[model samples]
Target: MSETLEQRAAPAPDGPEQVRAAPIGAPVEGSADEQLPTPTRRANPFRRALAGATEVLGPWARVVWAAAQPVVAVVSGLGWVVLGIGFLATLAGFILGWSELVFLGFVPLAAILVSIAFLFGRSTFRISIHLNPSRVTVGERAIGQVLITNPGSRATTPTRLEVPVGFGLAEFALPAIPKDGEHEELFAVPTNRRAVIPAGPAVSVRGDQLGLLRREVRWTEPVELFVHPETTRLHPTAAGLIRDLEGLVTKTITNNDISFHALRGYVAGDDRRYIHWKSSAKTGQLMVRQFEETRRSQLTMVMTSDSRYYGDADEFELAVSLTASIATQVIIDQVPISVVTDRLALRTHTVTSFLDDTCRLQLAEGTFDTPRTFARETTKRLPAPSVVIIVAGSQLEAQEYRGIQRLFGPDVNVFGIRVERGARASIKDVAGMNVMTVGALSDLSKVMSRAL
Candidate 1:
């Protein structure tokens, strides 16, 4: 009985220790929770008020910013001056504590305001630009006309029009135009270089008398001027070792052929339709038509864009001119010619289009295989042997050309024209290939005259 009473009165083993330890709900000093750094962001009434105001005014601020972007883009050099002067005047007024200078600051401010008002006004004239003969040769002239028409019922204001040509700008002062009147300005485009010149959307800039705060408005669309490579006159028949109209003809007989080559003594199985009665009566023997076996009358012109083959940029230009001259002459003669350049090929259709395509041709960026290989690969796909003409730089080796000859395989009359710096234009026969080296563009016609 005493043992049962002592057991009930005494505390359990863990009861005292559990009571001594604080409950989870009670806070403890120097715990992990207390040791951590406080968060940088804390609730602030002032910041909350500012954010609430910003949310309220966000749409109006966005509207103002949207209106300012175009004005910033159109601002000219004088516009920047007005802005800087106004800013410095305001700053000086605050620093010096002078009321007069503060008012003086309004001078530039008022000038800018007036300039903005003038520039942002509605355009008074409609502008249109036309490029006459949009495609021209390198040395030919391209005419540009900017026509400004006053379409409004009232007289249009005098303004300045600027058009971008190549890398420069052409400016003109437009006189005050009557209602429903038009003014045209004529300008000559520089065609010294072979390139595509971009003539722009006419920009009309209106500014203050003090040259402050100008507004530029685009009034027309852009036009491209394609400057073609210069080419000399080459006679159609003066192509290469072979004649233009006929290829290599063989001594063969055919009953039906387009070309009347010759009449031959009639043999067994001769077609009666081909029997020449006049020749038979004169020779006292049956005569029949014999057609000369002819190769295909197709000319293949291969051009290389390999920089290694050229000694300088001038050499490349001469090569292009030579290619163009030959290609033009062949096309003019109505002989089907295939032109293969480094980055382009021409489908000999129109002289104008061909020249335009040649103008667009540019040299390849990296190294490439021998142009002869390219020529052979291109020729293999053709149905018949062609008179192959290759135009390249002078850096090519004899073995490389021999490789080109091997690539053409057989039956192709291959001709090469190499342009080099500090060299005279002359022709040479290299390993059964006729090659001409030309240093100048004028000598092209001379060389062809000698070769053909």
Candidate 2:
């Protein structure tokens, strides 16, 4: 800039030449207002948000770390202290005399080397997590993925990676993280009701260069694994009769056409029994009846919400699993099934067909508030005759079952199923309904067989 520009820019002792200036304490004429700029925060779109959590250690990692920290500390201390002493001796020799400089230098050098080793070891440590199924049904198994990854740079031997399952934790040592990636990891995912599997927290453990510092990074990608409910097959074994509620099978009963849905145009290879002659004669169009097997009686599937009877932890999980399993069987068997719950509306439609996954999740959670209310409203809307099947946890009392049964006609056949904790169960009487008790999901088929 030239002197002329500098002089032009300087404020003069005298006011602007002949310009009308605004009076003091008065608004200035035509003065533009400007706002100050503020810094904006950038959000991470890739990394998941840290929800209600403290510290990076995952639930599984915490358990393992708690147990292994003392051992690791002891080993790490012994190894590094010797190196530190060696380093101090080498430094002293370097300052005093040149004798044994190489040998003395080995001390401090060893200390630095040890620290670096620890740091690197901490960086290279691997953590493994196992999730049963990548895909699982809702309210069933939410086990997402088993993860094993490095959190350190240097090699880490005897590194512990323990992950929690249910309430207990399992520990394992991950192989050193090579330049490549985490080693072979396997997990067996359980069956799920929904279509997506839940994702668990990721584990990253890094050892310091000298194997001194250890950093564990926990990453949770909140994911839900979805798995469709398995199609139910109710095979009945009786004194003289054998029957699977599903599939095409005729049963001797008062109502042969009770399960028939609607008539369709007869085509090639049509069953002669399905032909509706009167309707064909009336419209001069060939029509046939689509007959589905009728269930024994009107059904209501009560999925319980009360956690007390369901208990805490996996017990509640088992109860929910039973509910979905029964729901699946009922729909597949062409049973006129209405799901009843304690609070809020989950799913209440008759399951003569497959209900979508959203409805299944709702049913498991027992979000549907009142069975009596839903039954009353459903009765007014749908006039179809149906039986009642109480697919619920053992926690619900017989009175609730009886109250639900009374909503339909007096002849409505109601069957209650009691869910057990594990793989063993015995039947118990609930009101007038025949209650079939079962342990584990494998026992559900047995209960359905009795229902048939």
Candidate 3:
């Protein structure tokens, strides 16, 4: 017998059947044989054509781009603008029969064509750059010489050589060079500040006076001129503050050390080697030799690069100078020293390399926490140091200075130098750290002597 449509569609009474509504735009659950309506839209003819064309012409477009790179490189921005204007003007003049527009366009077109002539000759001269005494202290004179030699048999045309000295460019005009002829030109570099200045890979530039076209041929590698921070010579005793072969004695008592303090009753974990037999016999108990804890003198110098701590550039420079002076003395004394900034560590194996790294030191926005936290995190990765020197600008608050002192243990001697221009040099104890304030580089030695 055939059942009615309503009866067939009704749910069975197996358990009160539940019906759930499907979300909008979601597919509804149905039998495998069920058919669903799907709306269809026709593809746009323009997009289809574009896709086909892009697929077919992609390789050819890349080939054209590769071919046009050199032409685009040689033409200056102004030259391209002029070329575009000339083409547009010429086209409009012919269409509207205007002779004035045609003549105006022809003038720029002719100028560009003639300007290309300057770039026609190849640069055949061998060029080199020499910086005498590549590294110098601040305020010292640095001389850089460019040597251009005509290595070919034929005489070369006149060209201008451009050498990039720091942020400025130095141009040298060359006369026509005969075969095997050499030309030398000297220029002075400004070393008024401590920095690492890059001076040239000398490039021969061929360009028109109007700057419509330019071609450059690089000849030599760039050389770095390190203008190191001016460091003051410290007294021999200054090294004593940072270096100690026999180690510095602290008040903390320990079972085993070189500096003998007293005899104490032995603890459970005490080493037997430190047990004093004579003291044990007299006291009738296990007594060990107590020592005034001695620590190997390893200096850690931390220079803060955070710009917020500095009142001015001079203060930062003074801080750097003071740090360099102290670190340099330690290096010369052959002491184990580690110099670091908030950002990274500086190489302090040799005086030259150390100063060169300092030349690259720059003030940057800090990403870490306070100076104390930064020093703690930085020094933990290195060997435990007995002496930690914190170099910062005067803007650092007194509270921050105390926080740094508290970061180290009682045994470690912490020193802080706050550089403030025009301020009298003075030293005071803050939270067990000897903090010194200095106005100039010369004040460093005096304050350091008193602080130690």
Count of steric clashes across candidates, in order: 0, 75, 0
Q: Pick the candidate with the highest lDDT.
A: 3
User: Which segments of candidate 3 are over 4 A away from where they belong?
Assistant: 1-63, 251-256, 264-290
Question: Could you tell which candidate, 1 or 3, scores higher by TM-score?
Answer: 3
Could you estimate the TM-score for every candidate?
A: 0.67, 0.38, 0.81
Over 249-326, each residue of candidate 1 has an lDDT whose tens digit, in order, gives 545545676667887888898889999999889999999987856665777787887777888766777777888888
**Candidate 3 lDDT by residue in tens digits, 1-452:** 11111000112234212222222233323211101112111123433443466567898865765676577667776777788789989889999999999998898899899999988888688988788789999867667777888999899888877666554455666888889988877766656678777767788889898977888788988887788888999876666788778998989887678999988888898899988999899889999888888888899888888998999877888888999999998999888899989876999889999998888777778757677778788887888788888889988987787787777777888888888999998987776568899998888888888877
Name the lDDT value of residue 49 in candidate 3: 47
All models: lDDT?
0.67, 0.46, 0.75
Question: Which pairs clash (backbone N, Cα, C closer than 3 Å) in model 1?
Answer: none
Model 2: per-residue lDDT, tens digit, 119-162? 34334434344444443333343332345455555444544342
Top model number, TM-score: 3
Q: Indicate the residue-level lDDT of 312 in model 3.
A: 80
Better candidate number, 2 or 3, judged by lDDT: 3
lDDT: worst 10-residue window of model 2: 1-10
Q: Per the 3 Å backbone cut-off, how many clashing residue pairs does candidate 1 have?
A: 0
Candidate 1, which ten residues in sequence have the lowest lDDT sum?
A: 1-10
